[model samples]
Target chain A: MDWRWDFTFDVVLPKMWEAAGVTVWATVASFVLALIGGLILMLLKTHRSPWISRPATEFIEFIRATPLLVQIFFLFFLLPDFGITLPPLTTGILAIGIYNSALCAEVYRAGFQAVPKGQWEACIALNLSTYRTFRDVIIPQSLPPIVPALGNYLVAIFKETPLLSFVAVAEIMQISKLIGAEYYRFTEAVTIAGIFFLVMSLIAAFLIRLVENYVKRSILH
Target chain B: MVPRIAIVIGLAAFLAGLSVATFAELKMFLPAILRGAVVTVQISVLSWLVFMAMSLIAGVARAKASGAVLWLAVGYIEVFRGTSLLVILFWLFFVMPEFGLTMSPVLAGVLGIGLNFGAYGAEIARGAIGAVPRGQTEATIALNISPWNRMTRIILPQAIAIMIPGMVNLTIELIKATALVSAVTLVDITYASVQQNQLHFRTVEIFAITLMLYYCFAQFVRFGGDALEERFSRHLSKRV
Candidate 1:
């Protein structure tokens, strides 16, 4: 295989960098939605009794099992048939948020599980209400440890932003495809896009690792 | 928070519109869409079976391999896991032919799904194998069973039991990845949705239906996996 190093520099790098901004925004916006949706779902699952609990649990399970792409398509493509016309970017962000929320819910559940039973008893003995217990006692304690998992999913959702191209969102992958078609250099275009993802993920991971270490140190003291 | 609230309200309104548009599509294309759903199910189930077999093989290789074999297995897993399945499908379908390895669209899609899932599965398999009690392998060795027999009769069944939860999660992932086969032009649910959307310009209706179809199918898989896990663990627990 002939490797054209200069082609990537001249043709692919600048185009992909421009596209990377759009992708990063989509990921961040979607991640915010995910965090909120996931928090709500986790609270629902925990606070509700059997009737509501079962449905919430099942919904989370369903979202967890299905692919994010199908969910995105369903929201973006199918909703308009019934009379909803959203911008492609909005739809892409919504879909990512909903799908990632399901994942975050699972992560929250695991984090909650990791909380020692004594902590719960301590909250109860202090006469804290359930809401206060969760907000003040549980979440603050559980949230820090799950930062790594949350960070991992953030990276995952960023990688998956490429799927948004199917809906014609002009994210990084869409940009790559555009440049590749124009230049007839799929290798350069795709490789540069891949590097963008790799670099971004590495930076995000390092930041998360730093946060995790800081949290650990503070908790120890 | 305000933007997020607006988004939620917007989504609710969108879903309301979807119901109206959905009825419109249903009047003209329900039969065809329902038929396409059947194809979607067929692809999901068949591909899942293949994924399970390949994942098991890949996982076993990952867990048991040493020296160069181990690195090769690790590299295989990393590449497949790292790249988007869409990129891989494009290469498999569009580019492989340039190298004289053309595949039928269905086979190519299945291979893409199988290989992608296999890579993820390998890691899960390694985790499951590591979780198995250490003495189990030693006990088999002491009994003088052939290594293959020992694996088939001893470690695998137990590992399968332990790995059920993870496998169930991966199965759902496979279901989602199948949508990418549309890139190679498989007329699965996503393709069907796109077609209906183009016909009616009611993009939301077709996509909502597609989402529900996948959600229901995924729920069924999760339930079945959990049930099977319960059954397997019961027998193991009883023996202990």
Candidate 2:
């Protein structure tokens, strides 16, 4: 029941901020993987051929239906059975990437659907190649609408980085727990960690809203 | 028929092979993990109930209110929606204890997930409520139905049907959020897996089993949600 202001000020503040850097890095790396991975999955599922698309749909559904933490645990622990051992950070990043990819795939699909069929026909009428049509016309039109949704998911992933602590990737939560264990002032340690997450998420949300506003204005214009 | 029988026999053989390979390991860990699974289900169900109740309130407030109440509801939705369940879990576990209010780790976890997802559910509920035609409310009033009855019988049931998809997504999210409870030192499936991995150094096997367990649990829930959705839609169509 006793709160320790000094410990919050002296111990947790400094330590958590330092660990926050790792959390941010993990978020960035995982988000990059998620973006690329999601784009690929989205493209695969939406491809012209049923042969390629059907399997991708099923795979995405499987991934979407499962929990990410379980997938992270599986990757961290199970990859070794196939003789693939990764560092904790790598494992954490891969897990976030794969899990977020499934959600992002849906986002991208929705974005793709939002593109009018007329645009595709217009591109084809102009004799643009499929690659050029997708790159120059379809994707540019489709992607902006999806930015806000993608941004929301990115922030969600940033918050989820704490789960990486379970695999011994010493992100913010793990660091806080260590600090708490060392000082026995879990109040200060965990509170500081929570504050760090809250602030980062707020900033992420603000930035995402800004992007959403920008997208809306551009679309309107 | 031969190919069908062959496929069944193949699957049986594969299952037997996996069992032989894993029985010793599973024998050690399955009982512990299954016990943990009970806690997992309890936390999941309790949080789902809490979120649904609180979300309905928040959603209705957002839908009906005009000024500061609306803003407060919006703020609640944004803060909880933006933040991770893990941070909420940590706050409830560590910060709440310092505030002279300590709960069992399980309670803390359930409340955190409930409140967090409740915010999301509120948004879905609000959207579904808004999607209900404005004419429906006018018609209910014209018919002299009590406001409470109008909402309970006419508006809410339809809104729930519409909200099912979003609610299903939130439910899956709640299931995942239960993993964070391990941080509070509760012996969840993840915790048991970690304990076994540490003890036997069979890290991959233990974690793999836990992953499969989660997939199985999640698939079951998703199936149930789908069935509920079908039932609701059928009932709605019959009414129409």
Candidate 3:
């Protein structure tokens, strides 16, 4: 195995870091979208009317049941047909956002359900509107607990970024693959990519624990 | 039950309508798609077996072992969990070959996905074991039950009940993982659809069919899981 340290340190590491910027930002953007979309889906799912809740639940299940890669492929392939050719990177962002949004929706559901039944009854007794109930009462209570779960999925979304390489997203995995192809040696670049994921996700997990502590402290205060 | 029945009926109606609309154009592609489906299911099961083995060995070790053995389990669980499946899959495909050990793409995929999801399942396995009531252990001790009998008869039964739901979720994920193998040029359902689309350019129709196929497979796996759970938990409600 021609593991060239000079080439790895000088040539590969810099390019890996450059490509990592794409991976990080895409994860952030997709996660932000997942957060918002999850909230909306959760609200829609728990809506009082069956008409609203039923289809919303099914759609969430469909998204959850299907592979994210297929969804990405579908959107990427279909868009070019309708004469709406976007950048593959943007397509990746949108697709990952949509797929993870469904997962986040389930987390939101679990969080909301964890809120005690009396809270809902209290809102009902006060004759609070649904919007007011969720806003002043439900959201403040529900959002905190789900942060750690959401953060876990955030790490998951980060790991998922490699799949974007399929559509030519120029993320670390794709960049490393290009390097390997060019150099005729895959071990060094690929190993570095794996190490980047392992280290960064460990750091993310650590940061998430810190955030979890912060959120818990704020709630206590 | 009524809503479930209605949903099932509704879905059947919808599929009937959709299939009628696309059947003519889809006829030629059905064989290829089915062949691809066979590959997908094959790899999903293959990887799932790998996942199940790793989950058991590492999970039990993490929960019950000590010293270097526990550290080995910890390393496997954390390393696999921390990294992405695609990276591992590619490493097995691209890097392992450099080590003078080459594997077919399918083997690389099964091992890659199995290793990744196995880490997750191990956590679930550990958690489930931890969830078993402490009193049960005390009772087994007082009754002078052997360790093996205590674990097999009492602890694992309850732990397995807790593990099933998480295991089911992971199994469905395994079905989905099979789709990713297509990225490595394995002609799974996803790759087949991409292949089909190039020929006829019926992008929407072909992918819709593929998605439906995958959804059905995932649902089938979920159903199996539910049945397994039902079997395991049947004794819980019995009155002694």
**Each model's RMSD to truth, in Å?**
6.4, 3.9, 2.5
Task: Give the CA lDDT, 0 to 100, for residue B161 in model 1.
Answer: 91
Better of 1 and 3 by DockQ: 3
Name the better of 2 and 3 by DockQ. Answer: 3
lDDT of 2 by residue, A41-124 (tens): 999999999999988986786677566777887787677878888898999899999989988999999999999999999998
lDDT of model number 2: 0.81
Q: Arrange candidates, best TM-score first.
A: 3, 2, 1
Across A1-221, the per-residue lDDT of candidate 3 in tens digits comes to 66789999888999998999999999999999999999899989999999999999889988898888889989999999989999999999999999999999999999989888999999999999999998888877886889899999999999999999988899999999999889887899999999999999999999999999888787645
Structure candidate 3, residue pairs in collision: none
- For model 1, state the Cα shift of residue B49 in Å: 4.1
Q: List residue ranges in candidate 3 displaced over 4 A.
A: A123-137, B1-24, B237-240
Candidate 1, residue B217: how far the Cα is off, in Å: 2.0
| Model 1: DockQ score | 0.29
Best by the DockQ measure: 3
How badly does each model clash, as a count of residue pairs?
19, 1, 0
lDDT: worst 10-residue window of model 3 chain A: A212-221
